[model samples]
Target: MERNLMKGNEALAEAAIRAGCKCFFGYPITPQTELSAYMAKRMAKAGGVFLQAESEVAAINMVLGAASAGVRAMTSSSSPGISLKSEGISYIAASDLPCVIINVQRGGPGLGGIQPSQADYLQATKGLGHGDFQVLVYAPSSVQEMINLLTKAFDMADEFRMPAMILADGLLGQMMEPVEFPEAKTHQIPKPWATNGTGMKRKHNIINSLYLTPEELEKTVLDRYKRYEVLENEHTEAETYLTEDAEILVAAYGATARVAKSAVIKAREAGVKAGLIRPITLWPFPKKEIVKASENAKHILVTEMNMGQMVDDVKLAVECRVPVSFFGRTGGMVPKPSEILDKILELGGAE
Candidate 1:
């Protein structure tokens, strides 16, 4: 089927509905408000629930309640709103309920601006909330990728029995592009542990984050980490470009990677060997792929819309084998291809 043009936020909303997402709970915030608005109009037509909660806090908790009942559920917001939902996210994580969350990020230290930014890298991949838990995170570079990720986001949540996040920026959310939706998932693995009301034939189920005994909590945490290790090994994904014989390797994600790829092409045309590695999944962070991509490179550059949040992860992956440098544009500003090329040239990448 031919694809249709759509804004990233609207595409994601439609994708979630097609993914069999039965419930959506969210509070409106800029850059992401269109997502909730789209859901409000379409979800009801699809026989699903679209709720505009009073606050981010209330919305996330409502998601928790619905997901625990074995229904596919979701919530979305921007940076500050995501911060408000963190506590509830941690609770959902601890309770092992499955749900999808979207963060169409904006500038921030505090209510920074409604403009596009990737400042929430650390927050999404690292310390989203207080716990040893890790959520699967996907960063989509375009509106089409947003649809693909949003559809898969629900299955990942259900398959792992944990929260999964679609980490996008305001640029992707606001822009429009052609996108195609895969057919609705026809078969889903049943979640027996869900707190569906018990009938007379079965025992009652409970879903809660509390662990009154330290020993019990310790065991639970350890078990969860074991599961994460397995997930990290199996799910890490990234796209590599021109790395086979490049001298300088650029690492980026989301919309920034698209810009970096343009610079890489320009560099190659100018007789400079440059390549790119765009991480598709952020949490299981394609570490080995990055290490390998830098094998023949003279230098590694990490570009972001934030002040180098993901650079730390890149450094850890590179393991000091090659020099790693960072260039960024914060406060809602995005870097252009020429700007990234300049940084590449400054790193002695010019041939």
Candidate 2:
């Protein structure tokens, strides 16, 4: 095992290289620009393909082109660039091509800010594209998860013949942390259930999600929903810190969770019985586990970097009588741990 103190962006690029990804296509975008730059410098030596496409649209199309050839491929961008890739993402999902799209999320709605934010949760899990298809969006809160999830993203894409996203934030992208690359197994790539080109084998198959007929489309949605249900059961993951006998439960993820962790510690120090629930997979959402906090707590505090995007999910999970409240700073402003602690204290005292 090798240990390296690398930034999350660098770790992602490195993990891609080690994951046997053969192509990387992306444009320069803040927070994630380092990932593209690193790929540009390393792809050739790694015997892979790396291109700085003219635009994110072009880049994701290039990803589509490579992935259709049955090779592992990827692209990275921030919020603005990801917007341009939306059409291409829809196409990839519709085609059921295997590929990875990394979004190191920033403040958004349009050109928001470069600071870290979890505001992309809705866009990633729900904003897959204009169609009824879904992308497997993985939210990595730490630099280590950035490395680990990249490999898992590639594997899942190939296994399910679907697109997977590593949804991160500026903090996870730019922060330097220790990560060890996992041992490689070349046969890890999924078999050709996905068409590289049928040639003489099994005839030509068009892997598309589009079905004009109502019945046909319903069947496709049903199949996709089944897969999503499997993901929910197998992939739902979360971390809890000190929820036993807690008066207030603070729920946060991505960079906000880092702040929430500190706040929880402080609240505990102050004897507030505050605790935290940090989600690792935002899509499967770990809602069941989070709701359990409400079973024992008087109130649940949802902190975020946007105007309460996650709070809605928290409320749904905790249900009405739990007194769910929201605290946030939009446009890239990250509230400090002390601020979060204060909010929790206020909520706890109210209870």
Candidate 3:
């Protein structure tokens, strides 16, 4: 298939429809508005429902309602709106529903700027809700990957019977590129466990996770952990470049990763054995891969659009055997390749 040019947001919308997402509920937010707009126009043709909920909170709840009916539902919002949706997300997680959410992050700690930022790394990986639940997070660096990730997000949600998120930033959401869809395959159907209501030949089933009993809650938590273990083994994926024979390795994801690639090239030209390890799944954190990369590297440089979020994960993955460092810019400013390279040189690690 020839690659088709698409903006990241549009690509996600198209992928959602193709992946059998029949319900969409969302309110407008910058850097991701195009995603909803595309859905509004295309959903009808695709036999999907695209509803513009009155607010982020409403949008997320609408998704919860639709998902409880066993329909593939979705919603997209930026950081501030995402914060509002978090309350409902807790409910969705508590209910053990299957759905997809997209957070095209922007600068934030508040009504932060609507520009590219990696500040939400911890928020997405941590429990967004009050419970001991997890969100399957896909961190895509390009429009093509953004499209591809949405497809995978649906699959994971059905397989694990949990919510999955495509955690992209404004940069990746707004960028334009050519993307080719995966080879034709029938999108898998959700398990019969998915509720279609119980009035015919089946008994009624309730899908809420709100157990009042402490013993039941403990069992639920342990059961969810077991499912996550399956994900950690089967779904975690990452990309590594030039790691072999490289004494210095750069770690990053999304737009920050694209910037780090340039640094890797410059360091290589300067006779330094510098490489890159780009994580595609932020939740799983690619720990095993980073640990392997650490064994052969002397220094690991973690770069992000925020002060230091993913660096903490890198540090944990590598442990104290190797030195891990960080460089970043926050509040909507993306670091330049040359600037990151300068930091690498200053560390005396870029050769």
Best candidate, lDDT: 1
lDDT of 1 by residue, 171-203 (tens): 999999987876656246798888887777788
Judging by TM-score against the true structure, name the best candidate.
1
Model 1 scores a TM of 0.98
Model 2: per-residue Cα lDDT over 1-351, one tens digit each = 878899999999999999999999999989789999999999999999889999999999999888877789999999999989999999988777889999988888788888877787788888777877788878777788888888888888787778899988888898998878777543465566555767786877566656789998777678777887888888778888887777798888877888899998988887788988887777877888887765788888988888888777777776676888899888778898889988988877733
Instruction: Order the candidate numbers by lDDT, best to worst.
Output: 1, 3, 2
Q: After superposition, how far is residue 341 of candidate 1 from its true place, in Å?
A: 0.6
Q: For each candidate in turn, give its C-alpha RMSD to the true structure in angstroms.
A: 1.1, 2.0, 1.4
Better of 2 and 3 by TM-score: 3
Q: What TM-score would you give candidate 2 relative to the actual structure? A: 0.93
Judged by whole-model lDDT over C-alpha atoms, candidate 1 comes out at 0.91
Judging by lDDT, tell me the better candidate of 1 and 2: 1
In model 3, how large is the Cα lDDT of residue 234? 71
Model 2, runs deviating above 4 Å: 184-187, 209-212
Clashing pairs in 1: none
For all predicted structures, in order, the TM-scores are 0.98, 0.93, 0.97
Worst 10 residues of 2 by lDDT: 185-194
Runs with alpha carbons beyond 4 Å of true place in candidate 1: 184-187, 349-351
Report the lDDT of model 2 for residue 311: 75
lDDT of 3 at 200: 88
